[model samples]
Target: MFPLVFLTVIALDQLTKHLVRGGMALGESIPAEGFLRLVHIQNTGAAFGILDDARPWLIAVSSIALVIIIWLAISRRIGFLDNIWGRLTLGFIAGGTLGNLIDRAYYGYVTDFLKAGIWPAFNIADASMVIGMTILVFLYLRSEYPRSQ
Candidate 1:
């Protein structure tokens, strides 16, 4: 399940980026009913365009994070890894990390699209990483301080 989820996220992320890169011009925007829109832009930094000038540093950090995520997934040392949510968390995070890392390594930037309202443009990998981290935090808190009856 972990491998499946991981690969699926990577595949979807790469596929969408590829499509956006090939089909749309850089900075192009296509309104999609309401406040949603598809955009073609490159992000050279982390979330919300932070550290836009630190490509090399961002890549190094992402690589290290990927390694640690893989290690934890394989080691299963974390008690939560025994559950489905844990597996999903690792899979999504690892997949997302690798997805962006690939872009940073190959193009020195990440291809981002899927914009909405006032939010900056982002890709599937960002979404996956956010979702995974959110779940992980919830799990950690639940395990650390179980509710008392």
Candidate 2:
């Protein structure tokens, strides 16, 4: 399951990046209109543009993190990828992580193409990661709530 999810994400991420790289130029933005656009930007940093110039370190850290996450999902049997909610969340994150990891390993940066007003340009993988995390949080909260008193 993890492998399948990872592959799907990586395929989608690479395909999108390839299309954007072939069609758009650096710093160029294509308006999707209504607060959305496709822009080509290479990020050598982590989320929100942190550590913008630490490619090697970022790669190392991300790789390690990915391994740890996978291990936890498989070994500890965490709820982040076993049931429906877990599967969905893990699928998104696995895909996103591999997508960015591919960039770090091959291009020394992550290729970000999707953009929206006030939001950084990101790719499908990033979206998956964000959405996955959001779902995980929602599930956690739901589980914590007391049943009807």
Candidate 3:
């Protein structure tokens, strides 16, 4: 289950990035709707364009995350991947980390294309990470506290 979710997310991430890179020139935006667009740009840093020129740092940090994720996958500590939600959450993180890691190793940067007016440009990997993190937090909270009726 973990492998399936991880592979699916990675495949989707790679495919979307590939198509965006192939179809759009850097800094080009194709409006999809009201305030949404497909904007192609290579990001050499982390979210919100922080450390815009810090590819090395990004690579190192992501590498560490990958290692921890791998360890969790192997050890199954903290009941990691114990449930369907857990599998999906970790899958997103693993896939997102690997997606950016691949770009860092191969191109020295991650390609981001999705754009929503005021939001910074991002790709599927970023979305996956955000989604995974959200779910993880929710799961933890739900486990820790039962809702009072």
As for candidate 2, its clashing pairs are 81-86
Candidate topping lDDT: 1
CA lDDT of 135 in candidate 2?
83
Candidate topping TM-score: 1
User: What would the per-residue lDDT of candidate 2 be over residues 13-100, giving only the tens digit for each residue?
Assistant: 8999999989999988877465888899999898889998898888788788788767766774654345666766777787888789
Tens-place lDDT per residue, model 3, 1-149, is 66887888789989998998888888887874558888898988889989988888888999999889867766667553567888778888998889888888888889998888899989888998999899888887777334432
Against the hidden reference, what TM-scores do the models get? 0.93, 0.86, 0.90
CA lDDT of each candidate? 0.91, 0.81, 0.84
Assess the local accuracy of residue 32 in candidate 2 as a C-alpha lDDT between 0 and 100.
42
Q: What are the runs in model 1 whose C-alpha is more than 4 Å off?
A: 32-34, 145-149
Residue 52's lDDT within candidate 3 is: 85
Winner by TM-score between candidate 3 and candidate 1: 1
Clashes of each: 0, 1, 0
TM-score of 1: 0.93
**Could you give candidate 1's per-residue lDDT for residues 5-97 as a string of tens digits?**
899999999999999999999988896455889999999888999998798899989999999999998888988665889999999999999
**What is the lDDT, from 0 to 100, of the residue 85 in candidate 1?**
91
Assess candidate 3 and give its TM-score to the true structure. Answer: 0.90
